[model samples]
Target: MADRLLDAMARSASRLYGGEAVSELEHALQCAELARAAGADEELQLACLLHDVGRYAVDPSLVFDTGEPSRAGPHARGHHEVGAELLAPWVPERVAWCVRAHADAKRYLCATEPDYFARLSAASRHTLRLQGGVMTAVEVARLAVHPWLPDALALRRWDDGAKVVGKATRPLSAWAPLIRRCFDR
Candidate 1:
């Protein structure tokens, strides 16, 4: 299962989301690197690495090829939920929860932090509106106590910073052992 999952990531590595300087794999590797640099636990690192797997899982034709704001429909299965669901069988619940909530964490941060929204990349900012825009006060109150909120928020920070063009990082294969370990348990 781990091999198959990693293989899928490898196959989709070159497919780029419009406007992003980095490919999906690059973003994933960078996010994972950020987590590791911050001394995050293995599960958190894995969560960061796999948070966007759902984008690859879905039909590529359905994904927006342009930088335009993505609309709801096929894209709404949400890379977050899809990735979490894919990893749920093998990973810790905390890891799955982090993957699932990362998108909402973005929305949460955009609402609660004054400068956060402005810091978002153009693609991210566009997706934000499509992702239900800023959270309502009620939504904020509910997410405040979520068990995985902090990790999700942390992952979001890494996700945002991972889009550097031509940034160097370890290859995807380097992550296999960690991914296998998460699955092995």
Candidate 2:
């Protein structure tokens, strides 16, 4: 399973993350680096690494064909949901939850922090509107109580910061042990 996940990521090494400056693999590696630097536990670091796997797991025709997700096509599952479900069988439940909630974490931040929206990159800003924009008060209240909210929010911050064009980060091969541990768990 770890090899499967790593292979999928390896396949994405050349694919740019929509309009982001890095490839999808690069973005994932960078996010994992951020999590590791922040001293996040292995599960949280794993969550950061695979949070966007849904974008790769889904039918390519249905996802990011254009700069934005296609609204006209068959109801495409959100990448977050897809990613979380994909990893749920191998990783801890909290790791899956963090993967699922990272997008909502962005909405939470945008709603709760005024300047947060402005910090988004152009592609992210475009997707934010499609992703439901700021959270409603009710939505905010619900997410606030989720046990994995902090991890999700932390992953979101790393996600946002991982778009550096040429940043050096550990290669995907270095993560095999961590991925294997999660799978073995």
Clashing residue pair totals per candidate (backbone < 3 A) = 0, 0
Query: For model 1, which pairs clash?
Result: none
In model 2, which regions exceed 4 Å deviation?
61-73
The 10 consecutive residues of candidate 1 with the worst lDDT sum are 60-69
lDDT of 1 at 126: 76
Regions of candidate 1 where Cα sits further than 4 Å from its true position: 60-76
Residue 152, candidate 1: C-alpha displacement in angstroms: 0.6
The TM-score measured for candidate 2 stands at 0.92
Q: Write the per-residue lDDT of candidate 2 for residues 128-177, one digit (tens) a residue.
A: 77677899999999989887798999999999999998999988989988
TM-score of each: 0.89, 0.92
Backbone clash total for model 1 is 0
Candidate 2, position 150, lDDT: 87
